[model samples]
Target: MKLAVVGGGSTYTPELIDGFARLRDELPLSEIALVDPDERRLGLLAGMATRMLARAGHPARVTTATRAEEGVEGAGAVLLQLRVGGQAARDVDETLPLECGCVGQETTGAGGLAKALRTVPLVLDIAETVRRLAPDAWIVDFTNPVGIVTKALLDAGHRAIGLCNVAIGFQRRFAAALGVAPERVSLGHVGLNHLTWERAVYLDGEDVLPGVLADHAEEIAADLSMPGWLLRRLGSVPSYYLRYFYLHDAVVEEQRTKPSRAAEVAAMESALLEMYGDPSVDTKPELLEKRGGAFYSEAAVALVASLVGDRGDVQVVNARNGGTLPFLDDDAVIEVPARVDARGATPLPVDPVEPLYRGLIAHVSAYESLALDAAIQGGEERVRDALLAHPLIGQAGPADELARRLVDANRSFLPWAVSR
Candidate 1:
């Protein structure tokens, strides 16, 4: 099978490539095409991948390309991992929301909306190319604002699924906290990325949250350390999103404060600046290389395993809800568990989420709609409505003010902004 990874020069690309390489035997993958615009970065990655594969004794054909059409042609699966704008632009995406005294973050609030505006067009273009190049390829998107972008692709009449590691990552963390094997822990989780809830967790068919919380208080507290500590202090396991989760009064009241969107964006910016400024002196890539041995390898192997393993089940994927979520529109993008087999992904039926989950979904939907409208219809009012509908905005007047400021500040990227 031929698998193409779009945006192959990205920082995360190596990890993903390592993932596919580890899965060669299980999935019987025959070729890999790395696609990116920057030839230098692409070559750097391709060389690194070639060396790694040689070391591992795998000999799959590893090719590189600059054009989406060239890389996507005849691909069975296309992993979308492009960053619409590099870290510099993402720094703006994260800091802008905080400047307005609201949550500035990559996947929520004005920052997320801005990201979607920039990313939607690029992703749509790629989707169009895929249609012309590899009509049957399954698009597995690993982009930010996963829900919103996934919705946009479906709206543009493409088959795509948004993939975020947060769900599985959180599940593993919770399993560790509970002193149980990850596979032994069963959970019911639902909501948007970075803001999901653990509705339930069980070990041996018994509710174990209370016991785990009590027994592992110290360990849990230690694990919840970094980026945003305030939310971790409030309660709940510190998922990467401890910042934004804590800011919401509803979630705070439930003692489930995760990070705020602003905090996450800040951390991401700092990390990117560090990456760009001192590409020579950083141990991050090395650390990531070591870490890649597990996550990327295991995940990619799992993908291949699902394809040819003894148990044939479709992998849970992120795709358009299409009545899968009763409360939301049929076209809404959702990340539900999916079963993946040789044929493709089949999403599982999930029950209606909680009111808070629904509320977040609504806000995300409004933001997604505005992004799509701006990208496809060139409308500004829709964008305004999206900002107003956000939970952080609180009131219409404040939302309007925030919208106007965002439009003014990001005029270069958002050319359809209304005149101040």
Candidate 2:
């Protein structure tokens, strides 16, 4: 089978290519089309991918294409991993929100809305191309603001599944702490992308979450930057991104004192690219671990394998709500454990959520709906309204200011804003 990676130039591609090689048995790929607009970066990554695959004795042909149309053609799966305005734009997204006294994040607050506005339209356009070139292909989105992007694709009637590494990362971590193989761990992970919680951890069909917390609360809390008491009190582990909500003011203070994550990632990308160009580097570098997206390759490969091979196995993925959560609309995209097969991902049944978690999830889900509307039908008011709805930017004053700054800073990316 053939697979196409839309943002093949990204530093994350090598890690993905490594997974394609290591897990060749799980998902046998005959060809990989690396699609990117930057020919220089594309060439560097293609060479790296070819070498890595060859070293693994996998006979997959690596091809390069500058156009999404050309790259996705005849592929069984199209992986969308592109960044619309690149890290330069992400730097602005991360910093611009701090001006409004909000958390400066790329995927959850005012910054996340800015990214959604710029990304959703572009992703939809690509989905259109995928429809024309590879109609039956499953579009596995690993893009930021995945919940919003996946909603757009599903809204446009595309066969798509949103994939994130958060669930897989948690599974791997929990398995290590419990001294079990990664596959032996299953998470009762639920909520939106980047905004999820590990409600339960099952090993051999038994929930050992209480034992995990009892034994490893301090270490787990340290990783999430949350107090161990909070995990114990809630009887669940919140994703690290929840820190933005749980300790908003504290996080803002810390963000102000440090360089934006975009800056760090930018520098890391430079070093990673330099390493990618070296012929001797046939394997993924250790530095890639610090670059984040931990275990992304495993997650992506497994999801694609399940989808292509008609393996009706359960995996955590972002899929339509379909009444899985009684409060959310059927069309709302939710991140949860789902059964995957050739038909697509179907969210598994979830137990009733506590009011504490449900309230926050509902609030964010509402904001996401408005954000999607603003992304699809661009206007200053829609942007302002979406910002106002966000729990991080609930006040109208900052919301209005953020709306103006977001549009102005991202005018080049938002065509409607550009025309205005």
Candidate 3:
């Protein structure tokens, strides 16, 4: 079977290619294709892939294409990991929300809405190309605003799977926190990407959270190095996006206090910009090599390995509600644990989420509906509703005024907007 990776020049490509090599025997990958718009970046990725395969002593043909159609042709599976706009645009996404008195984080709120607006059209174009070129291929999407982009592809009438490593990655972390092997822990997860909760976890057929959290309080506090520390302190497992959650309340509470040194925050922005800057710079190779060893890459490799190895029933956060969340549309992109097999993914049933989570789902659903409406009909009211219904907007609004300001501010990115 052939595998095609779109966004081939991505920083994550080498790790993904390395991952495929680990599973090449099981999947028997006859060919691999790398597609990217930037030839320089594509050349770098193509060269890296060649070296990786050489090191592994495997001789699979690796091809590069600047055209999306050519890259996806004859592929059995297409892995998408593109960023529609580059880091400069993402900087706008991150800062816009703060300007509007809301948390200016990417992947949720107004920032996510902006991202969805810019990304959906491009992603839809790619999906259409895949439909024409490889009608039977399963599109595995790893793009941000994943829920919205995935829904756009499905709404446009294509077969695709939204994949997020967050759900399973967190499950394993929480299981280890509770002193149980990941395979031995049974878990239930549900919500939107980066905003999910562990409803339950059982080890050796017994509930373990109460005892685990009570005993591990200090250790958990110490380990809040990644996102979701506050939630963990409040007796819930942290999602991959714990940092946003931590900052939400912090941003609100610190409104009176002079903003302290945001060194960590500044450092992160600098690092991301440097990472996404010129690929021809001398230090680029070392940077990419170091990134190849991150936890995100490791998680991606583990997921691909699980699918190819047919390693029993591993759970993943995939799209398709299919009763995992009856409160949301059956066809909506809800994140829940899914069973993977050689046939494909089957979403495991999760009980209805708690009222708070369900309420959050309602908020997300509004934005998703607006995104789809805009994509289909090019309407402004739907987009306005999306902005007003966002959690951050609610926290920072005279809804009508905030919506108007955001719509006006982001007119350039919107599908339909009144004259500025």
Candidate 4:
């Protein structure tokens, strides 16, 4: 009946609150505790959430906490959406890897590994507190690098499931293109977090991907930044993040000339916080859509509803492999459709992955394993090894250089690097 949001001060909070308000019948809550370290932001969000709930005639009480232990206590579910170093650090994560001629994005390549090192430890620490304070609560992680973060929680024996909006975003898009209700479109989403593909689009259990692609290949390809012919050739739709790997050189060049995604988000957050301070603003603003995380709240609400109510429904989530993909280690966290319920997420059986996607998934899975090592047991060598293992930075020369830059840029967040 009680739910807690670990990074409730984030500008993303209102979008979540809007979902809670609209979907009350699915997941009824008696209270919501917004947990954050920044009191000013937390206060602003709390007021906004209160107004939204009141306007919706939803009875859930909104509360604020400056500590994880305080907010998560006695809650049925805790959602982790924190940024360990905030946007300033994200700016570094986005731009620092360009020096090595690598894709300088937040959730992949050298930048993703850097974020893992800074984030995993703090998330695990919060999970421990959740263990002590709310032993039965489920921790739903919506953090970047969901695969790595969820794996750390699971490996440490926490009850957690990783959630992302990518699948829902695709489902919604496909449904719109087909002029059908969103629920009627089921995606055969496969691979690891951020690295995934939609192999099939099922309408009423029929594979209609070919038809959808035939009609809107160019439009879909445009959204993913890939060529329309490529979609027809591959017989599947790769997630947008795949562009980083598929068009690495071009992306690197563009990243060199363009402002980082972090900078854009930082500016958006500033405006959103100011908007939240207004008492008259009771609803989520249109500007929030451009802030990204499209359909995030819906995905979160559905997952939480299924878990809390034990619906035993299949939904896409970042869950343990458990032999669903024979090529991957059972403990590897993968983004795929899974049956979610009281026991947590169990990935569904996947059809044979094409060698192209399978090899990359296995490769990234290995890098993620090493990235976790570097995250849990911090050291420059672990960091370098993880970078070397990444498909994007396979060469030792760039890996070594990126690892050094990563640590130097994130020393304040990575305690082990402070001595250097």
Candidate 5:
């Protein structure tokens, strides 16, 4: 099977290669086409992957391409991990909104909306190319704003599934806490993309979340950037991204005092690239762990295996709602546990969510719907609608200002912004 990674030059690619090496038997990889526009990083990654695969004694061939259309020609599956403007663009996405006293982070608030606008159109274009060349290929999107990007692909009639490592991260964390293998910890993970909660953790078919929370509350709470008492009160684990939503003002203030995550990642990428340039370096470096997106390799490998191999196993992922949550539209793309197979992802039944969670899910679903509109059609009014609908920028004054700043800062990437 041919698997193509669109942003195969990303520093995260080595971590993915490590997973493919360790779990080489899960997926039959005849060829891996690393596709990226950046020639230097692409060549370095191709050699790095060759070294890693050789170390693993895997027979799969490693190939590199400078064009998406060329690399994805005969792929059975394609993974989207592209960053539209690289860390420089992310620097804007992470710092721009802070000027307006709003949460300034990628994948949320005006910043995430900006990323959606820049990314969705480009991914759609690539999807079009895949359809033309590899019509049966399954698209596994690990792009930021996974929910929105996946929705765009599905809306365009492409077969796709959105994957996030948050669920896998939590599962691994919980399993370590329980002294069990990662696969033994099953999460009742629910919500959209980064906006998710672990309501339960099953160990040997029994819910042990309460016990985990009781014994390891402070450790888990610190990871989520919330108080342990709050975790005790809520009886669930909220993903760290929720901190931006739950404590918007506090987060903004904290963000103002520090360098943007993009800047930090930029420095990290520079060093990581230097390491990848070393032909003697075969394994993923220790520094890559600090680069974040932990457990991505395992998550990506397992999801691709399920899709290409038609394993029909259950995994937490982003897919169509399909009435799983009564409040959301059937076409709404949601992050939840699903039974994944060759056909597509079908959301598993969720326990009735509280109105508190449901209301926010519904609210964000509305924002995403509008966001996708602005992303696809592209207009000033459409951008305003999306910003206003967003819970982080619901008021007119802040929404309008952020929308203008977003477009202005991203004009290079947003064709509509340039044209207008």
Candidate 6:
């Protein structure tokens, strides 16, 4: 099968390439088109991918294309992982919100909305081109703000599914704790992307989440940076991103002292790229682990196998609501477990949601809808409205201030941000 990775220049690509090599039997990758506009990083990543495949005796041919159209044409699946404004832009996204007394996060709050605004249009354009070049090809989005971007593609009538490593990360952690294989663990992972909760963890088809929580509350709470008492109260584990909301002021204060995550990632990427250019480095380096996106390759490979090879497996992915949550619009995209195959991902039924989580989901889903509107339609009014709806910026004064700051900081990337 032919696969195209839209952000093939990324340091994350090698992890993905390693999975392709190790799991060659699952999906017979014939040729891989590494797509990116940045030729330097693309050249380095392609060289490493070729080496990794060769060491595994996998006969997949690795190719490079600077344009999405050139790379994705005739491919069976195209994976979107591009960063619109790169890490420098991410620095702005990660830093500016703190000045407004909000969490400066790249995937939630004002920063996430900025990312969505910059990303949705670009992803929609690529989805449009893919529809023209390879209409049947599945668009697997591994981009940030996956919920919004996936919604954009789905709204435009493109076949797409959003992928995040959060569920897989939780599954792996739970599996280790249970002394079981990762496949044996299933998560009742529900909510929008980056904004999800682990309501249950099933092993041997029985809910083990309560025990895991009871036994590992401190460890889990430490990882989530949430107090153990809250986890106990909720009877669920929120994704780490929830830290921005549950502890908003503290998070803002913490963010003030640390270097922006973007800066740290930028340094890591420089080192990884240097390593990628070395001929002797045939295997993924240990330093890649520090670069984050844990278990990304495993998750991406499995999703690709299900989509291209028709495995019909249950996986956590972002797809249309389709009444999975009655409160959400049928067309709204949600992150949940779905049975995926060539036919497309079908969201499974969720158990009755508690009012606590449901209320937040509805609020954010509404913010996301407005965020999507501001992203696609583009206006100061839409931008302002989206910010007002965000749980992190519920007040008009702060919302208006953050909106102006967001537009000012991101003017170069957003056409409308600069147009006005």
State TM-scores per candidate.
Answer: 0.80, 0.99, 0.81, 0.99, 0.99, 0.98
Off by over 4 Å in 6: none
Native-referenced Cα lDDT, model 1 = 0.64
lDDT tens string, model 2, 92-211?
Answer: 999989987999999999989999999999899989999999988999999989999999899999999999998998998999999999878899898999889999999988999999
Residue pairs clashing in model 5 are none
TM-score of 2: 0.99
In order, candidate lDDTs are 0.64, 0.94, 0.67, 0.94, 0.92, 0.92
Across 1-420, the per-residue lDDT of candidate 6 in tens digits comes to 899999999999999999999998887889999999999999999999999999999999999999988999998899999898899989998998888788888889899999999999899989889999998899999999999999888888998999999999999999998899988999999999988999999997999999999999889999888999989988999999988888888888899999999999999999999999999999999999998888988898899889887888899999999999998899988999999988889999999888888999999999999999999888878899999999998989889998888888888888776766
Kindly list the per-residue Cα lDDT of model 5 for residues 1-420, writing each as its tens digit.
Answer: 899999999999988888888888898688999999999999999999999999999888999998997899989999999999999999998898999888988999899999999999999999999999999999999998999999999999998999999999999999999999987789999898888888999998899999999899999999889989988887999999888888888999999999999999999999999999999999999999999989999999999999888889999999999999988999999999999988888889999998768888899999999999999999878999999998888999988888888888889888877877
Displacement of the residue 224 alpha carbon in candidate 1, Å: 5.1
Cα deviation at 166, candidate 1, in Å, is 0.6
- lDDT per residue for candidate 1 within 119-195, as digits (tens), equals 77788889999988888777777777777777777777776766667656656777777667776776555555555
Span of 10 residues, lowest total lDDT, candidate 6: 411-420
Off by over 4 Å in 4: none
- Residue-level lDDT of model 4, residues 1-420, one tens digit each, is 999999999999999999999999999999999999999999999999999999999999999999997899999999999998999888998898898899988889999998999999999999999999999999999998999999999999999999999999999999999999998889999999999999999998999999988999999999999999988998999999999998999999998999999999999999999999999999999999999988999999999999988999999999999999999998999999999999998888899999989999999999999999999999989999999999999999999898888888888898888887
- How many pairs of residues in model 6 come into backbone collision? 0
Candidate 1 off by > 4 Å: 178-181, 204-207, 217-239, 248-285, 289-297, 300-316, 342-344, 408-420
Worst 10 residues of 4 by lDDT: 411-420
Q: Per-prediction count of colliding residue pairs?
A: 16, 0, 2, 0, 0, 0
RMSD of each: 5.5, 0.7, 4.6, 0.8, 0.9, 1.0
